[model samples]
Target chain A: MSCDHLDLALASGLDLLGPDEAREFALHLPGCPACRAEVETSRLLLDALAFSAAAPAPRPALRRAILRRAQASRWRLPGPVAAVLLVALFCAALWLGATRFPVLPAVTRTASGYIIASLDPTARSPHAKGEVMLLPEAGHILVMADGLAPLRAGRVYEAWLLTRGGAHALGPLHLDGWGYAWLHARVPPGAFRGLLVSVEPARPGPGPSGSTVLATSGDAK
Target chain B: MQEADLPRRLARGDARALAELYDRFAPGVFSLALRRLEDAGAAEEVVQDVFFKIWHGRALFDATRGDLPAWIFAIARNTVYDQLRRRLRQSRLSEAQAAMLDLFATSGFEALEHLMAQEHIAELLAALTPEQRDLVRLVCVDGRTVAEAASLLSTPLGTAKSRLRAALARLRQTLATEVRAQ
Candidate 1:
């Protein structure tokens, strides 16, 4: 037996229904076994179709990077503590103004041991731009970026310190409505090659897993 | 490690389990992304995003509800859709068209117990008439709506819809027979 929702079932199985239509179909699915079977069969077909695509092996480095990130995730602080620390650091930054930490416009080394690096956009995000400021003596790194394309839900921009070993997660770069974000983090003791910002899932991973939005030349390497 | 034990190991924060999961599914995830995005770099990003979610969100996986591979592929599918949506937005497509693209967005589904191998799937696709194949490609592979596929193929909307329905039914019946034979 057929019902009025047959077309809706087909479209839903193909993932061609909008949110509203899909929801309506979903509500009707439990009561209608015919529509349910149609949806299941269509999904099965699509799943088979998905496997038809060519499967090229990913680069080995990508695998290593993911593993390293997974390992580092073990050391991450709990959410509440991290948030409190971030707030304290932001308050500290406000207290120490231009006199203590003067903003440098170009890639220059100030006598106060502040090293600045420019972050250029990658092909993935051409219009995005950023700057990195490093104060090694004080063990602080400041990242400022703008012109970023807004990410979809459950995604965010994250900063990482690139080293000879692997990437070290800085933290999430919280962006305002204008696609501007600034992150302040203590520079971990290590020989750093450069820094980069990547688009990552909302649940932060230890390494750069998403597309590189902004990066130093060295970091891109 | 047994496939059935993966979810448990991953939830216990076993790094080896994550690596094993990646080894099993990375190629399929990359292939799906590369097919949809057609850019190697972007496809790699999708691979990373998929694994990252699988690793970090392991606790959310309930083996009672679905198997691990199905859950993994669901994440892969959703991530690819996100990439597509981002591309549509960046291209400055009109709001109406963007809304239409939303129709293709999925909230994940339970995957089949076994997907046909690439060669087998290709062979099955080859069994379809050329017109039916093109219609499937336009809507399923190219992410086009039925109306859009109809317009592009110079066919009536109702005809295109019927062709798609027929194509899916044929494939499903063939696949079910193959499964039973196994």
Candidate 2:
């Protein structure tokens, strides 16, 4: 019929409707197949983009650059905010760093020789975690210490190679205040099984004695 | 690590990589801002702001927590919204910018109508004169409600609604014809 009146019929909006006009429109939609299709088309498009607005992608370079800028400008953030952000970052980094991939201190193994880095009683880890070492000298093994905190006076440490049979004493490891440590010892042919560090009483003895401080397996490098 | 890797590379001062990312997304960002701000210069500025955010504001982007694209978009969106609010607050539009804004108003609707290939939408848009085409684009593609379009066009709501209804009628008629032909 006369769609000149159709303007009045449609302005109520394709998506929205009032009670009486909506009822009339509903009746007309099923009967008037064309209007039904038209409504369906509009509805489809609207449905296609209902919740989210269609966004064109940003340039990758621009995106990366802007993100970089945003991150940098974060430094320009006000003091309290910056502090809070940093603290949060520091905590996150520390947690991730600690749990995920803690650094493994580098070790140099000598060819044709066995090595070990024994621990002394007062010697402690400079870092929260540390690595003891084994080096080979000819047919013997030289042990080393790395990342251990310096020792306090009136104390010493001992080292032992624990095996399937029992523990063997590698003897006295020494260190001055920090960084890397080198200990000299003979790698008994079978003592190559496992090695450990223990905080021993201040006297040097011919045995793996005193309390076991921090014992670790002495294995092939 | 993959997520942090780029920003970390960027953190140490890599500019070329950032440019690569820029070329990738500029079109979408430009089109988005153009639709919202309706000014080429403002849109360009919006794009620049988006670039600055990704390049210099790497800290704001938590790749571990979110996708880079999403972060970039959020920032771009905020920049556009902020500019919109500022434009609204300004009591007077300098004659030059006002002139540019009016450019989008002229024949703008026809351009949008021409883009409307769907039989139903084409029918709806055919009833509108080129002048009313601008109103339809503002409502549809650019996402303005009729009330918003009326304010934008500086016309009465009744006038805009009337044009909308007429346009919608045309769409139905066009759709009806297309349906019969099919």
Candidate 3:
């Protein structure tokens, strides 16, 4: 096929091509630098997306919430509705003289994927230290850290996904009562080269306006 | 744990095995849903549902046929499509909205294509003009033939073809520049 036809064919999406034509294109593709590059572009797009999809991890509470609801019953209900049901069930059990409620197991979310980078505290943010785990296939990044001080009333710690495109604020890192925080971002693996943590104003700006207190030591794997 | 062995353990009714699987796949599954749905609560719901199906419906997956990630991602795609449909049905959707619904639905390919195509490409794709984006939604996202997208958009087939080429080219250009910038 001509290059024009090949471009149209690729743009038409794979479903358009007949099996024979697709097979023929596959045979022809290896020798054609241009077509090969186009195909690679498609793959790279998917990779970038996969990274973005995994950028935000679900709230940790979601796990306990999901497991609790799943254990409570097989019925699928929204989180608030499920909470109401559980409360009602508890009240009824109390009225009926049953004293025990189901015990919730300790829930921990471990990164089942590879380590993208291990971050250390910068001189400006000497208390910060953590590692970023990448679930590439899953399209998620988990950043957990300790020794972070609670921000002032109007301040927040924002995590940035430093990519060639630019620094994207992953979201505000919410620290729990104990000064420990885990930020979940839905970023595709290797889409960004590094991670940066900055203490910003209460509201975020286009980019970091505060000091880079913590960051990845090297290129993100 | 080995990914291959996890499913086998799950099939044997190990709760720990299921947890291990969840630890491994939840973020990926959740990310896919979040990118598509753009709602954490809904995305979380999707992740919970995907894992539930995997553990309870283990028999439906035959390992001899394919590996676990492919099977899990197939379920993820179908679940995301279901969520999209539910959202679409809840509102009086516009043509653009309906086009988005059609775009994300995975009908043609088996697992791998669904997984790859379902990744969050909206950012890179945002480089295209609105017109080009619509064409791409129809052709790539919706898995429509270029001719079909052309007909749906009421544009000539050649125009649709050129628009798609331009859009893909733009995506490549942006990606290349970004990589160099990094």
Candidate 4:
């Protein structure tokens, strides 16, 4: 499998290969140990370049600026549409009040430490993605999501805390019509291996009774 | 979190995951920018821009495309280059001045490699003539083809290639020695 194609090897490593040459190299690479070694060396050399540089600390205020911008950009609706939506929301709140459905709590400050888990790709919605941030210090966990679809009539999206002990249901999420939700819940102190979000029938149970729609790490924490 | 899981956590929009990633790589990003732009304030701006774009586009990153570190450095390089271009446009320099400035813009790559090296490698690199150093920077660090580097240096391609190959061989020998020492 060895070849004297040093030029091709170096060019491939540097991303200087033309499309056809790149394709040809891709085919050649699988069987060529020497070329693979050249590419590896190139990578190592580039890494050494990074490692040898003098990294100065970033300005402290930059962090706040980034966070502020991110927060401002999330879930923004247009101005006039927002006003009409507000009126509609007021009417819906009154109707919900008469129906006796509980109100959802807002997300607050972050705790000192948290464990994060990414939702499983298979269980997630087509365009939806989510993460579970376990805030053990504040005794609450935050489930942040984007592109989550609304459940069918009488169906709800529920969160579950999966630990070595057992699966603890945290109740259904209250998503806005746009399919974004930031659900926060109070919990007793505990470690978790994973978190699961699922679509369940009306009046969800003490355990998951339907297919999972999103999930964190599959293994125990 | 494991290094392997950082990308997943980022894709899920976890702030803590971002904080961890920032803390680990920000220094390198900041330093690369600082070396390129030679201004702390500008470098900080590059860091912010790079990380913000990374967060917003986290899901788009394909692991198969390249490792996170390489992708990140590419961003840093491009951002700094854009900034340099902007400065050049703003200055309204003559063609000759602009070309000289461009050389300075490109020269940062080698200086960065030198700055990033440890004592032994740094010592070995220091032994190289300034032209040899620039050749290494242009070809290896900046990812330029040998022919392109020769054209930039206004040297014959054969001479540039031979010189660069020799410099790289020395660097490789030193690095191997360092590994043995470790």
Please report the candidate that would top lDDT against the real structure: 1
Q: How far is A205's C-alpha from truth in model 3 (Å)?
A: 65
Candidate 2 per-residue lDDT, tens place, A1-221, comes to 34422433444333335467667765664355345333434432321121123344444465554555444533444457545644553443233222211111222121212122223222344232223333221223334444455566765656665545556555555552323343334343333444566666677464566655444422111
Q: List chain A TM-scores, every candidate, in order.
A: 0.51, 0.36, 0.48, 0.48
Clashing pairs in 1: none
Docking class of 3: incorrect
**A1-221 per-residue lDDT for model 4 (tens digits):** 45766456544534456689778877776576666665544444544554345444577677666665555543343445544643553343233222211111211111113344445434347445565554443344556565677777998888776655556666677564434554555445444445788888768786788888777643211
Q: Which window of ten consecutive residues has the lowest lDDT sum in model 1 chain A? A: A97-106
- Candidate 1 residues lying further than 4 Å off, grouped into runs, are A1-44, A51-54, A77-221, B92-100, B105-168, B174-182
- Tell me candidate 2's fraction of native contacts, as a decimal between 0 and 1: 0.15
Just chain B of model 2: what TM-score?
0.48
* Model 3, span A105-174: residue lDDT tens: 1111111222234455777877565555444443355565557777778888888866656677766764
Task: Give the alpha carbon lDDT tens digit for every residue of B28-79 in model 3.
Answer: 6776675556677788877866765564455345565445665666556556
Would you estimate the TM-scores of all the predictions?
Answer: 0.43, 0.29, 0.38, 0.39
TM for chain B in all models?
Answer: 0.60, 0.48, 0.59, 0.56
Worst 10 residues of 4 chain A by lDDT: A101-110
Q: For model 4, report DockQ.
A: 0.12
The candidate that achieves the highest TM-score relative to the unseen native structure = 1
For model 4, name the residue pairs that clash.
A52-B116, A52-B117, A53-B116, A193-A221
lDDT of 1 by residue, A1-221 (tens): 67888767656665556689878987887687677666655654564465344345689999998888777764453456656865665454333322223332323342224455667788998877666656554456667676788889999888887655567677787553434566656554333457889999987776788999888763210
RMSD of every candidate to native, in Å, equals 16.7, 24.6, 21.2, 16.4
Q: Kindly list the interface RMSD, in angstroms, of each predicted candidate in the order they appear.
A: 14.7, 23.4, 13.6, 13.8
Winner on lDDT (2 vs 3): 3
